[model samples]
Target chain A: METPCLVMDADLMEANLHTLQAAVNRAGKALRPHAKSHRCSRIAHRQVQVGAVGICVAKLREAEVLALSGITDILLTGPVADSTRLQRVPALLERAPHLMLVLDSHETARILHQSLAAHNRSLDILIDLDVGLHRTGIPPCDAVSFARALAAFPTLRLRGIQAYAGQVQHIRAFEERRTASLTCMKEAGQTFESLRRQYPACTIFTGGGTGTFDIDIEIPALTDLQAGSYALMDADYRTVQSRGCLTPTHTFTPPLRLLTTVIGTHHPSHVTVDAGLKTMYRDGASPVPAEPEWSHLSYEWFGDEYGRLLTPPGTRRPRCGDRISLYVSHCDPTVNLFDAFNMIRAGSPAETWPIDLRGCSQ
Target chain B: METPCLVMDADLMEANLHTLQAAVNRAGKALRPHAKSHRCSRIAHRQVQVGAVGICVAKLREAEVLALSGITDILLTGPVADSTRLQRVPALLERAPHLMLVLDSHETARILHQSLAAHNRSLDILIDLDVGLHRTGIPPCDAVSFARALAAFPTLRLRGIQAYAGQVQHIRAFEERRTASLTCMKEAGQTFESLRRQYPACTIFTGGGTGTFDIDIEIPALTDLQAGSYALMDADYRTVQSRGCLTPTHTFTPPLRLLTTVIGTHHPSHVTVDAGLKTMYRDGASPVPAEPEWSHLSYEWFGDEYGRLLTPPGTRRPRCGDRISLYVSHCDPTVNLFDAFNMIRAGSPAETWPIDLRGCSQ
Candidate 1:
């Protein structure tokens, strides 16, 4: 009804869902769509219904939201906690019976095993292999020892190995990104192979994103690719390049756009909009107005509530009532800012998708 | 209940309300608490009850929210135009007869005056003066011409000027910030003085923040200081050096803190919480744990739903079930992310304060 309402392109969203599925289908790998992008349970449900092998959530609480939405197969991609959020596990597992979790430490394995002793059932666990991303996960070589240590926890099952190549996701160099992806996934693949020989029934080895979806298809070992942003392409994701890999650039049409209204025009050369940092994310890049007509005007940051966009010299200046459509620098947090989305088609407002999983920031 | 909830300290919030009142009372300035910080009608109502001259809002829709809350004195600080929102303004005026609107554009004044004429009445307006912050305000020198331009619309009443010193608010150095505040506000003061020498009845000279609250008390000409962060001091505001000023920062404790439960602790050295960029504002400063014990651990940028906190080198780590309290970097946007807050007291179950003003991004 007003400016700053998140506009989701449902048609493009479905296209993104299918695109990820198509990649997984061709690669003969599993499709586990990460829910971090949309964060909405309804979107996760759609991804599941569209033949995703599993949905990957970043937190245990997020896993709960998805599980409550009737998704049975899910992987809480981050390290599963023992003392911190493990209390939510049983309830979450009860909501959705078949759920998998990632483990990166021995203490976690011990805690989960001991905590769930009453059930005496091994939870589906995947050893998070740290290939290159220094953020989290264990080193690939340390995967076996950790798995053996985790085996002591009879209730925690070491299912497979997962190594996400995030560093290669935004690679601008084509050949460099391809080599980087293969090198990282190769280590993950080797870890999976070593673990499989030890466990005899190791099945899952998943990694790769929109950037490596094409290259990962050739790496015989990765079981699945977890890519999320492919649906609503952003300016940042549009730059992903890799030699012999999929062209992430312009592969998916950009669907989401923030419609903001010009509220101030005192300085003829400068205009202010109702949308500011609170309405958009500026961590990645400055928001670009969709139309080139709104060009010559560069959006400038003016605190949290005001944006002083500089109008190009001799260009058409924005008036007080003009509605300017802008593309957010990043998609995830920008979407998180809105409670509901105006899921629009080509012409009119179609359906209102309440970001149902909103305020579930936990 | 979720792991992370906005914990608003009502008692401290009340104190901050009084603090602003005292600052303005001493300076003989009108205290118009900016509603942009809280965005809650309940909070706006409280500010009105506590002798605030008016409530300053960033958006017309937000002004509508506060106006509907039965607040008679209101100031829509930012320029606004949507017919839907502007249409509501006249009706809002019906409830609160003394509503004031702010504008930076001649176009806004024209449209607003047109709307006011259509309603067969006049509306009061303040020309937003751009100070050193170089934000959504006209240059100080053009304050009168901008104010005088609205004279064509007989229905629009020129109600002095609105100059907000946002840059001086976060000046971390005490003496330097004090000097900068004087210089910035002096520039704004000169505009009001020059206009008054010509027009005679220039009534308001408003500016100041939590950072310059006590310092603003020294500006004898300032009619009122518009500060909202005092109600909920944050990590960024915590660094506001008010050493020389009698503004009593030691006693002015923060009214807001994010209560987060340890969600992920599978890692050995560090742990992860359920709050991330979505629950915390990263623009100003980093979040800190409320507990003094967590001093060793620092929060890092974890993806959407998780905050990766590094633990003290080799200490006995906090377990999964541990409840860690997080002081948000900035209260405004962090509070905007939630649908509700836990109106918390020291050692309390917390009453749910519905963030009724949330999702009002426009």
Candidate 2:
């Protein structure tokens, strides 16, 4: 019985998987959930079993991990440059065979072409377009020519398009979030139409994450969706615009919780918990208490080992040795801190679920 | 090999241990380097071998980890609570026999006393004082009474007073940092002075950390300094207030590096790296290129696995597959994210150093 263990709900994870699958089906679109959120091959395999056409891995290493686990189709949602990753790519492709890596420009296409030619191999490549999020991806207007050039490359095949609308993911307002999601997908849709005309044939146009998963589901040319983080929703995601849209029936249940114990009573109104910056992801914000009345209590991170609690004056507090649950601010990185998620059912002996992806930082 | 692994320079770590030991010797302060930094029992053992009086563990689980490794003298610097940690305490004591757990309140003291008495065991304790951190520890005014009252607990021994100046750690002004460190020590000194006068046989007085290792070297009343992270200086610690006084020793050898490879040439001026927020600590800031000038590339987090780079317009770019070395922004959490440290020596193949203290997060 370790304090600060990651508690995961298997039932909830199953529900979330069903929920995302239903979302894609209801929208009549292909599904390709991102693997970065969970980084679990078991989860990846589950996604595929539930009808996700492919998986989106944040890194080639992640792809390698999943590919070895028998996930055939994967999209490298993020950029890849390093020679080591390039050399490793062919091996992963050799294993997965149905892999597709995303790229944003002709330069990336050219690099892939040259490098793959040197290795006497070809790759399935998708042109990532800057639909709305300007983080990566080429401009949508430049998609056709670039897609054509990448399509023409002997060492690479022009798949379709990839656009992840990060800005839409956290949108809390229903109408506004839906509008933003549509706006982002609409921009990518135009590029897809142009590319479709340019090639005179439809390619595999894919993109959209949990935030915009529903948005791209019905997009005219969008062949699939790349949704991650829906299985284990975080506090921040719960506050997003789509939070309401994800009704209990449609909700991607949160399976993750940080089970930490009261470590010290520093103030009569404050206690220090072992889950701090090292245990929790303090990037978005501190987690909210699971108890209703404990709302007044907030977490203050002063160091890596200690998380401070500012409880309401005269609030009935738990004594030393009491356990409290924390809803992580964000699920992805928070889970990254854990080595395993202790799967606990109501009144059942907890089972250890190794977060196989926890330290898979590579 | 994983693209980004937490690699530790054993040579550098040993050198860091020596540097701290030398400072403690020169300053005449007792050494108790905090174990939170490396979170490795092996590293803590090495520190003890290098003449450290004891090791400071920030959490109950950390104490368990080190204690299991046969560390006799250990201090739980923060708080200890939860039935699991409490029940485990006696077991830990049976093995180590000399472990001190800190408590900031009588409530927790009562819990510890009752819990220990139930087990017919007693544990040494330190009264943590809020020297300046304001996060944990009782206020200085309340520390003495808190420490004095804990003496009545049959199963708990109020062995000493623990005070730490977290702000002083970041005070870059060398003289100012020293001044702040001394002032903090003086404040704690006053509290200890009160205890010294009241309890004529007060046998223990402990305080100090990596930032104040030199400052507390010879403090008359302070018996220990809990400086950790010295063995692995990160980008954040390198800039701790730019303290002008403590001629910033290049002592923090940059041994731990994330060996990443350039994955894609998405942008013209700069290439996107395969490693992103997932691979390195971005708390202080993104990892700067080890050879910044040669790379002449600036980084922006594009996505989970993508670090956007903006190279100078005319600069030669990193082609696909170029290996890039990066330092973590904060060493501890970054280390916590990795399962093992790749131990690379000058002539040997990289060996795997198990992050034995990793899952000990609980």
Q: Candidate 1, what DockQ?
A: 0.48
A-chain TM-score in candidate 1? 0.93
For candidate 1, write residues B16-35 as lDDT tens digits: 78877876776666788887
Interface C-alpha RMSD per candidate, 1 decimal = 2.8, 2.6
lDDT of 1 by residue, A178-245 (tens): 88889888878888988999997689998877767778878898888788777666656665654554
lDDT of 2 by residue, A1-362 (tens): 57777787777887888888987888778788877787677878888898888888776667877887888998888766444456667777788888888876566567667777877888887777777665567888887777667666788877678877887776666668778878877878888887777665457777777766665676777778787888888777666655455432135656777777776665676876777777777656458776565666787775776677777787777655667777787777777777667776763546776656555556
Question: Relative to the unseen true structure, what is the C-alpha lDDT of residue A234 in candidate 1, on a scale of 0 to 100?
Answer: 69
Q: Which 10 consecutive positions of candidate 1 chain B have the poorest summed lDDT?
A: B243-252
Please report the candidate that would top TM-score against the real structure: 1
